[model samples]
Target: MIRFERVSVRYEGTERPTLSGVDLTVPEGELVLLVGPSGVGKSTLLGTVSGLVPHFTGGLLSGRVTVGGRDTRTHKPRELADLVGTVGQDPLAHFVTDTVEDELAYGMESLGLAPDVMRRRVEETLDLLGLAELRDRPIATLSGGQRQRVAIGSVLTPHPKVLVLDEPTSALDPAAAEEVLAVLQRLVHDLGTTVLMAEHRLERVVQYADQVVLLPAPGAPPVMGPPAEVMRVSPVRPPVAELGLLAGWDPLPLSVRDARRGAGGLRERLADASPPEAASVPEPAAPPEASAMPGAPAPVVAARPRTGRFARLLGRGAVARAAPVADPVTRVDGLGVRRGRVEALRRVTLTVAPGETVALMGRNGAGKSTLLGALVGMIEPTAGSVRVGGLAPARTDPRAMVRRVGLVPQEPRDLLYADTVAAECAAADRDAGAAEGTCRALVSELLPGVGDDTHPRDLSEGQRLALALALVLTGRPPLLLLDEPTRGLDYAAKARLVGVLRGLAAEGHAIVLATHDVELAAELAHRVVILADGEVVADGPTGRVVVSSPAFAPQTAKILAPQEWLTVSQVRGALEAGA
Candidate 1:
């Protein structure tokens, strides 16, 4: 029920248009997916249907966009609220009420719905989205994934005919993502609701799409067709599609079930072979400017980390014999954290050695973020102790803690304040007490094409994440913590980040990141630690941990089955080695 007629959008400052000559008609009661790399106008196009393009964002729109026979150009976002419901990238900005129950009811109140009708719809949405337990919780106190559900539930309560979602599952854990996607499926199938969604994580949503619209590049018109047809020509792809292409399958698979059904011959070919040893994090790359600066302290070049499978083997001795320091970089002992009436973490104990990479994984609100906060001195544990480099994180001075540990939270914007990228880098350098150009050089390495003049807010979510990571790494902290680190990054950007993080581990920095991307955990993490309900459920080598669990396994691991292959890289390595 959405139509775009020769639409093109251009902002005031730049010469190139964000979207060029895009013409498409979204059929009623179908789910349409918008796929592309970052900054390719996917978000801008979604804005057009909700009357946010020219009406709210102040951009020039050359063509017409209509939703359900109503012209978006003439009807502003407020006027069209009855027909459309939109949930943007950041859920915090979309919130107007304090509590979950209040937020869900506010939309219907504004539409002048009767009290009884609003109450019924609110209860249905709460049960459908699994937010009944959190109906009374404050929006500010919920985790990132929880906030995302509340935002979606708020829009859903109004019962609008058309729904527009941007990265709906990016912040959610695997099971939680599945629940939200299943709800969307019901709306599309049973209720005949129309949905248009833009997301970077194709692995989670591609198989559910009725039609796929691809924006191949900047200033390029979109290609529309079935999911498989468009994915063959698209530059970016999910792990299942990547594996299908690698195995020379006639038709690429979009889901694990499809890939497994055709993986018999490929698994036989690999039965005699073994997956490649997981390499240690690559040596950290030093900024050229920092090395050349006069009077700057020389960067420490630590020994390369232990070889294979993990930083060290999963059992017995995990710390390398050649490690520079005898003490662990960070330690948590019987940790317990309480937020209001909920126990966020309890009796959680873990340790990270020099040059080790660990991934914390679990469902939404599983205490992963709470553990990171304890390490970074942001939260005080109600019970137990937290130590970073022999100093208590909660008791240490702010300046001293910066050198010991650095954390990049789920909201990357919290760490950003400067107007321009250059200014942000300069401030990071100063805060880290490092060379003037240190942060910028790291930014250049992580995000190659980003300009210095670009505002942090102007950049897409992925670009903003890259810059925030660079800023945090500038300090050269002994321990680093990242929460949902790959929230907005595409595959290419994620590869670059993996390379950079590997190098840091090689330079003897301890890495602890909380994430939901199974592929990332398989590719980069030396060890996987699973948490559930504020307790560690499973912790071991990457292969053993992921291969045993269906929800936690990557596409490659799922397809290659009882053979224990975790990623496509390992499979390719076996093939190249004559297996």
Candidate 2:
């Protein structure tokens, strides 16, 4: 359905082509997954099919690209709208209407479809994506994940033969992500629609791919084959694949079921051994001397028990301490936030203590983002109270709030305004009153090799996120809140972020992040709080909450449980000790 013939794309400013000599083809009715590290042209490759690369993006296209036998060079995006439907990473950027129903019909209306046809297709799409209940809701009021589903539904309503999705499930919770993927599966299997998608969260979608396309590096020829074949050498891999590699399995398993089926011997070997000890929380970093930073509040110290160096290094100190009963860095009581007629958050209450990391999780529109907004003063509570470091967030001055708390929203662009990365970092350093190069140093640590002169808008989603996170951390806020923090980060970047957050938590900084990435929660969170219908439904230690709920469990937990294991690293640690 889609074909590329030695296609190469080079933007106006740079010398090296983003994609070089990429000759590939996607047969009709097939679901092809584009996999690669950040900045490796996955987005560039997807754009070629929809004619956004050389057309809207103003790039040089060296070879022919066609969809359904019509060369993209001869057809612009609008002219080929009937043949291809594209959804970019940012859903808000794709909307042209205020409400869900209108957004779904906008594409069809642009194509000049008859009103009857457009109406029928709009309803069908809403039902297919499970958005029928939200049909009349305003687009601006939807959560990040809801906006994602709406964006996809808008494209699917057009019934284009070929669907191009960039990070389709990046913003969705696990269950919602499964729903979207299942819908795509039906389109490919039952309706014979061709799908080409690129996503950073491989564990969520890798198993569903009919074929895998790996863009290993810029200017390198692309690798195409079955999912397992590409994953064997791909730098980024799902946890199941990583486990398979570690266990020396002949054929790597892409899904949890397959991994479990092949793990009989390993499980038997582990049956006699006790599960590896959970890491102990590290000692909270000593507070800065009162004279060092005048007027700064003293850090809240946790009375943690002694732990080993490894536990301290991993920031697992929470495991060694008794239940925390006091000194909450953030407290919410009967918090309720309303937007117009919708009750976004209702009587939601939670607490985060110093040196602890809490992951707030729920389905899309489950009030996770709303709670984060309330914590950072972006959304005011209408019927309850919110406190960060003893000050009401909604009423705190912006300058003082920066020291007490910092929030990195789902869209990193909202925090960035400077033209260049260097300038942004400089501004952050100056505003935070930190050392001149502190922000840049944090950026280099979070995202190495990003050029100082690069524009903030030009960085990939993951890189941009890293920059935003660095900007927030420069202040060393006592309490940190991040919404969908791992949207575009690859595994290596995620690991680095985990380490950074671990260090911060060890230093008595409370970290609260809203995320759909269960793997991240399993790795970094001391506690898991599940929100549903704008209220906390489950709250407990990470292992307890995630393992009991199938929808929230990570791949490793699903495979290794009934055993309480949550990560491959934990399994590896146990095996190493036994060996």
Each model's lDDT = 0.86, 0.86
The lowest-lDDT stretch of 10 consecutive residues in candidate 2 is 294-303
lDDT of 1 by residue, 470-499 (tens): 999999999999999888787788888999
Worst 10 residues of 1 by lDDT: 316-325
lDDT of 1: 0.86
Off by over 4 Å in 2: 275-324
Q: List clashing residue pairs in candidate 1.
A: 281-502, 282-502, 282-503, 283-503, 284-503
lDDT of 2: 0.86
Candidate 2 residue-wise lDDT, 311-339, digit = tens: 66544422221233355797786788888
Residue-pair clash count for candidate 1: 5
